[model samples]
Target: MAPASIPRRAALTARALAVGAVAVALAAGCVSSTESGGARLGQAQSWSSVAGGPPNSGRAHAAVSDSPGLVWSRSLGAPAIGVASSDGLGTFYQATVSERGCNLFALTADDGRKRWCLRLPTDGPRITATVDGRGSLFVPMYGGVGAVSAEGENRWFADTLGIPTTVTLLDNRHLLLISHLGIARVVNTQTGLDASSELPLAGEIPPADPGYGSPWCGSGERGCPAPGPAAVDTDSGTAYLTAWTPGAPAPELVAVRFSPGETGRLEVAWRTGLPEGRLGVPVVLSNDRGQVHVHSRDGSLHAYSTADGAPLWSTPVGYRPDTPPAVLPDGTLVSGGRTTTVWRGVDDDHSADAGPAPVVAVRPEDGRGREVWRRDDLRQLTNPAATEDGRVVVAVRSGGTDDEPGIAVHLLDGEDGGTVHEFDVPAARGPVSGLSVDDEGRIALTTAVGAVYLLG
Candidate 1:
């Protein structure tokens, strides 16, 4: 599929102010996480109930439960930086900018009620926040980590050097934080502090004249480095970070592991030089699958072993592969790229079967994913959320040929990408970024403007 060239409009009114406030809050040191224990404030619930694709794809997932109804929409004093939804906990969190600094909000998921809000002192635009299994929200600040309770109270804080990139709960008590400079830290969730040990980078640093630094170094500066996303293994308590050389011809993908013990330590586990070119985030498949699937921007898929970082196989999917491979329950890998080719097959230690296998059923020995069927009607930018029984839901933005800009929801048969239901959302103002299905089989879509709509 060709890149959808939707004209970029000015930032939404609410988002603009929200972003401005976020910058101020970050500079003032106002952001922090919660430390006090309360009623299991919010329980982590599965967003989807559908099953039987590879390992990573959720069987039962959450879609927009409410329809074209406006739960609540507020203009951030600045631009909106990030948005996240907690497990069935009637609330979703958003990071936005305000005049004072960066602000975080806990809004009622059902009616968009403003449950609680916290302000930070940063002015930077790049912000990432995540909620743990215990309903504790972790916000990575410019030089530290902030913890907040679900009820909107500051718990504890920790300081660091490099800007934090990703934060995840290693367990109920430990939080893993990754920085752009290749630094990984494990913090005690209860204390809001890091252990003495820290991981170090192994390879030689590039000459830092201009563009010779890490990708994340130049986010706001001219011609800065572009950092890749980090993935963590929840069960092993290990964190993985990937990066490329400044001027390398073929991109080099490096994987390092940080093991937390009495003395925390980071070690270079395995590194592989790719065919040359930048790579995207490497998605880790959990449940002891021992495989890391990485999709490159140029449309290539590579699989690596989680244990030793050994390259298992590499294959081309299409011109611009955006969505990560969807791991079905039976071990059959369902993945699609730009060319309308949704590849499906069993994921073994062997190389990916060369030449597109005619969309067919594949059985996995592990009883994980069984390719029951394949269809060509399903096209999407993100991974298609599956239903508990066997339905796949996708979002598509229709290019306006003359006067109409529309978005459509297509339900596909899980076995084959056959169309099951098609509904067009008229008067859609922008591109759709998220598509979710509720427990009652209602489809909810989130647009770039932060408007979420329900499709029949």
Candidate 2:
């Protein structure tokens, strides 16, 4: 099928989509395993889920271009939310909100045309969906989990006890859904049924202290668990997430193991306490080692062993705490942050802030994080994706101090943090809210105002 151009609103259709012809190699940090000990057909080469697929290692193997040109752009009726997922071959899935419910759009990656849009009346706020090779999209929403086919049909819906914070693709047949109330459930992708019953992630919790360190205290709520997505290790059937009771001493990184079978179960593997701070992004796994890293809002990055959740190391990178680090193929981690400023408003009437933010690279060594390089230029970098050449690609809100006036796509050398290539987005309506790089070197970005752009 030839890709169509649909920059404006169009009628929704339940048309069948053709499977992509091109085949891509597996991404760097993504583990795509099948029951037959082979890679899955369409999903193996795709950025199938958030954070560059299951482990949420924030890594990929796309080609970086010296000058990326826009391939196409389409505007949704509402702004897209969360990280967009791509099937890598030729389709991308993004979600936008409406008054009644959520609208999930399946756009052709080649020309930014919508293949179909499925409306979900009970779909929750976040729209990060997980896609499989057989044209299945498993979405976690407010009331429950909904499965949609590639031809834009509602396959099934499984209700959950609480609102799911994130949906992670665990393996070939199962998905891991973590909810806000510390509930974890594994659902079968094919049947859309619970493989495991609702399991409380909080192993043993002390009674709640009404007004002590509890955000839900004022609202007369009993429990408030830290909300974020889980990172899965497909090989070991282990998934990691941050769990904290409102009045608990400290938050903990919890690892849960899911055994898939007729009697599938979700069991807590281990838990490790972290310093007092809100959890930042999703927990990320080290690409080469058995360590999992957590970024705390207090500007500290903590690493722990996956086997027992033992403390590995803690390092401070005093910048954008909300952004997670991207693990490269060589085991180096890259993250972006802002610089420290002393006496900000004292200099002028307006708050005089620091000029250039930093993009730092650190090597996780034995009991230490060795600083590799720091580039004090890039700012507002989305969760970065490592390319095939060990380089990093990021969407910068602003290219640099005097570089570009609008949103820019930057390809930086991972070795020295130098700009290898940069291109400004022609008509960016809003900030680059979501970025996903595919196996064929195509960079897909979504704006806050619902514009989706593809460049290569």
Candidate 3:
């Protein structure tokens, strides 16, 4: 484990800055939006502190809220994939499994309390979950999509033709899901109608090669390829998905629009050839003046037009950006890695004239970004969450090794990149995921092993 390289500020010159500016202008005029919003989103509330002493081992995800308390914490077996939080409910949702089968849990925001647990019928090797505006949790199970109410009740389930990959909330009442076989489905969040008709694919699959023998296959057994993640726009009924074929050299990116129809329209928005290697899912920056940011394992950030899938700009990022980039309300793009860098706009136009280079403000103008302040001393993995009182809280641990395992809460000065306050929560072991904050300013963290901590 080598020290992550620090980006040289001097290297980011006039030319590169100009490119960023151009990218923003281009995105402003060309990017388009999709998705419809119906439900209200929640926010975080309180505080707590977990001290270092015991050795608890289990991977888990956490959620918090001040009005109610600490939400629930769920375990993700040995290796967890992802965790998501709902706006006002104080309920944290995560996808996990034990020997029985894949499970989705809805937990209370005040304590490590379980609200409702929904178990899948089949053995699902991979799973992902997200919440709609209406507070329903949509999870992608093995071969179908499972809808769970915020109160922990099972709503309904929709079967899919292929292995389910990703599930995302489209708006308050609509949801979108994609499968490994390149099938994208849109369902009415309230009724669970097969809104697939409202999408563009129209039951067409990307051509497959017989000789390729399922590029994702292995050892005489079918190895399900890691399906690309899906991103949605709550304001408009638009969805974006990316997929790569076994024989194809690059990942295929697709954009689709969803509305009130049976047969939706599908179009090959944009396709870019990627280098030979495993690629992460394409994350759509909904508030990003209409641009899709694709992060590659090779440490490259590629920007595409949300409207037509046109390639806009490509730049090198710090680490293999595992988490999605955080956008502030002021249109400042705050992406965290070895270090967090703030971009003023979305495109290739890099003009110094853009007013102070888009510092990480708490709010972004495009409603896509907020300003950010960074702590160069702390190493972080996921994006930091902002408190209602304007403090940006991040989850950090010892940068290089497992010996010094801990989580830190740094209060950032929203105006300038200044540190307002710092606190540390000791951990029993190393490698913790599922970090979140409650309304009262208490910090909740889940370790790699199955212990949950309430840190203030």
Candidate 4:
């Protein structure tokens, strides 16, 4: 099949998914050996998961780019429709949703070897894949979420809970998820089922206001944003998110306290209305320390206490960031904008809204930032993918042009924002999607078409 262009709508033709029956006995953050796989993948949490590390931090620890070589690349044979994840040790995973069906592949990151293929009862719109701390790869499908063990054994599966958001590995015992409907469910990784039929592992979102002028909380599958995906703190059993409450003037950041065990239910602990007269672009960012960060449409960043939705610091940047800032291991913020950092971009001005802007690393303390570095030539930058070893991966592309090369992936020193090296995208075009790292410090890019690139 030819590589696909950006898709219009993700349509899944699969039937009700089969969630394998796994007996549950959550004994100290471990699952029983029901899986056929001998042992888990690798202990190297190198670049596991889509966002990079366990909490999906989008940060890795390995020094991968210095020895630049296209170790290998694999063509999914179809356009990849969603973000990609890696076990980091070796196994890399992604989903291909097409007119036929949703195809999931577990490829060896070291050599692009096809280790296992897991197909689901769903096709594309947008699905996020994650690798459990223990090594199980999870894919959120239309009817249910699918889990495959490291050794290529089917572990468990469950339903199209609702408009699905990405999965978060909260802690050893529980897996957290939020549907488009704003309902939250906690899955027992060991049991693969809720504690009881009515254990109440669900939460509800605020009702939507029909009177709002703009379309509310839209995603790839359904644009209606009721309860968005959350930044969870497993220790406190708390979820921080934003929802467009009905009858309200705008969306508000909500802190929900959830019951941890099978008896989990949602409770709106507290919520703060987003400041009015901004773009209303609400994304939640969290670190292990319990601080929740969100970027407003206006040139400002807001920090809030995840405990009670208390305000922390509100620093004003000059430009509205297009995406949530990437948090480095040291807690510096990397955000995109026009002239907020020290290094001014040298790219000549054009009419594009995204011109030669600087990719800056800001110290979260005072909302002050310094130019980590900027490629004057590379205008529209992808979110910076950082590794714990002080290296950050950035994918850049020219704004508003398809004929030119799509995106160039670069490795930079997170400390000084120095360029380590750049990877070549063979036949690259269009903007790149899901620029992420795995446990091995290898960077992966899913093209607008169906190809997946693994560079280190």
Q: Best candidate per lDDT, number? A: 2
* CA displacement after TM-score superposition, residue 376 of candidate 4 (Å): 5.7
* lDDT score, candidate 2, position 32: 28
lDDT accuracy of residue 336 in candidate 3: 38
Q: Pick by TM-score: which candidate is best?
A: 2
lDDT of 2: 0.64
lDDT string, candidate 4, 288-398, tens digits: 556777766566667777667777777665566544466777776666432111111233242223444456665555433344444445444444676677666776763
For candidate 1, what's the RMSD? Answer: 9.3
Report how far off residue 49 is in candidate 2 (Å). 1.7
Q: What lDDT, from 0 to 1, does candidate 1 have?
A: 0.46
In order, the Cα lDDT scores of the candidates are: 0.46, 0.64, 0.43, 0.54
Q: For residues 1-456, what per-residue lDDT tens digits would candidate 1 score against the true structure?
A: 111111122123223434543444455444334443432332234331111111334334433322223234443344343324343444456564444443676655565567877765321223435664445666765455666656665555565444455566666666766555445567877666676356534233432321133232322111122243355565565555455443545444455555667876656677666563433333535335666666555655566677777777655544433333454444445553221111211231212112222222222334233445654333353345656565556655444443334656666665666767666665554434444443334444555444545444
**How does residue 10 of candidate 4 score in lDDT?**
32
Which scores higher on lDDT, 2 or 3?
2
**Stretches of model 4 off by over 4 angstroms after superposition:** 1-15, 19-48, 53-56, 123-126, 151-155, 195-223, 226-228, 276-288, 316-322, 336-358, 366-377, 398-402
Show how many residue pairs clash in every candidate, following the order shown: 95, 0, 93, 25
Could you give me the TM-score of model 4 versus the true structure? 0.77
Distance from true position, residue 425, model 1, in Å?
4.1
Candidate 3 lDDT, 1-456, residue by residue in tens: 111111223123322433443454344432112121433431111111010000000111233232322233345453332333433345555444333443455566566577766544321222335554345555554346655555555555666655454565554445666665566767766556676652223234443421122223111112223344556554555656555554455555666666545565444444444452334333545344377666555655566677777766655444453334444333333443321111212332522111111113223333232223434455564445544443455555533344444545455544554666655544334544445454334555555454455544
Which of candidates 1 and 4 reaches a greater lDDT?
Answer: 4
Give the total clashing residue pairs for model 2: 0
